[model samples]
Target: MRSIFYIFFFCLGFIGYSQELNCSLVVNAQQTGNENQSIFKTLEKQLTEFINNSKWTSRSVAPQERIDCSMVITITDYSGENFQGTIQVQSSRPVFGSTFNTPVYNFNDRDFSFRYLEFQNLIFNPTQYESNLVSVLAFHVYMVLGLDADTFAKQGGDAYFKQAQTIVNYSQQENYKGWKLEDGLQSRFALIDNLLSPTFSAYREVMYSYHRLGLDVMSENAKRGKEEIASSLKLFEAMNSRRPNSFLLRTFFDAKSDEIEQIFSDGPNVNIASVKETLQSVAPMHSGKWANIKF
Candidate 1:
């Protein structure tokens, strides 16, 4: 009985040792040219507030506890008539790292023409812009977590998947949406649509990675993982089929199931030539058809 008890305690310790969550973010801001101390100070305060208020992670880790993060904002160009700036955010955690860099969100003198010239020249409305910034920052955190889950799963980190799922579950919650620094900003704010617009393809790619990871986990124990993989694959197929001109669906079809299986079986070392061959076979059939379309 004592030996059995010791074994059980050892197993518990192993589980505890395997789970972890930590992250950090840096914000950088700059103006087009030298600006008054007051303007710079205002921008710094707004950026800091957004970071402090936004719940960037689902794991309940505090911002101060984040491992490494940096943000730099540069006012790149400020003509008397127009103000331009740049904001770059860099984040890192034990499992992942990412950077978001963008040109200044611009505002013109004409728009501020009526206000006191000093205040008018400020360009972007900090109050209005705060929500958008928060959205971008928050989503970046989500993406990093999602990708980390995939990477870790491939490398045999089941705990990471649980962490990723926590993030996904949190994002779907009404209360979580209200956690943003700016209460007035609606959930799924325009920033989600804008910052994520060009990366729609990348989203689909991640879905595929997630599906593969799910399948691998499920394969280890069919009864335990099967339902989750099936659900994830169904969602991926539906999304790929619906997207207009989705390169992934086209590529998937062109490659065919056999090729896909081979790629999966071969793991990450699978070559592009084999993938291309599979793509050629599968793409033709599914080019215009939804993956879920019924006969």
Candidate 2:
């Protein structure tokens, strides 16, 4: 009877663990001189709105689960050509009587040298600072979700990235030029593709770097395991072939062309389907060129 009870409890715990919800976001606030209080309040309001409007998944965690998250925007003493501050965001859903916090990301000790453009103003010039902001925020949110942007990029998770890129893309459409505040808020989807593309690009670079770094590490240690080393080299070559101009790829391949050559001696087998799938993931499904790309 005791064994049966333990088994039942174990299954319950496992189910609970698997059912935990995941939420993510990035918060940006300005730190003007002597207006910290007002700025903070505005940021809090914005943060609240941002959370409420986001599409959080696995809503079963809490009956009232509505994008449960918190954000901290601190204005630093440093100031100059760019506004300096820190953004700390924690996104989570209640699990087992405790909130499972997403990874705490610290965009601290940084500087922002851009125009104080309202989230709505970007609709006029989508390729400007707003696009950059969207991309940065997307990367932050993905990291917080415990999803390595680099790995996901290579594994063809572009749709996840595209959701982020849509924010930028939508902002550029002419129809929303005179959009209202509420409509502007909803238009964030436009920038999703712009935001996520850079992330995937960066991920490709990092993976290539890691492969080269691994090879160098193994050169000193022959018993470093062949299977693992071969796998890294294979992935590196594959990613490099896809994005040859990537900084990490250029650096890695340039430094160890011989090793990489040997690894892919059998030639490369391009995965066109995977690439298409990845592109579709980050491409805005609702508008623009994305509409032409069939899923």
Q: What are the lDDT scores of the predictions, listed in order?
A: 0.37, 0.37
Scanning candidate 2 in windows of ten residues, the lowest lDDT window is 100-109
User: How many clashes in each structure?
Assistant: 34, 25
Question: How high is the lDDT of residue 214 in model 1?
Answer: 42
Candidate 1: Cα lDDT at 190: 26
Per residue, candidate 2 scores C-alpha lDDT tens digits across 97-132 of 223322212222132222233332222222343433
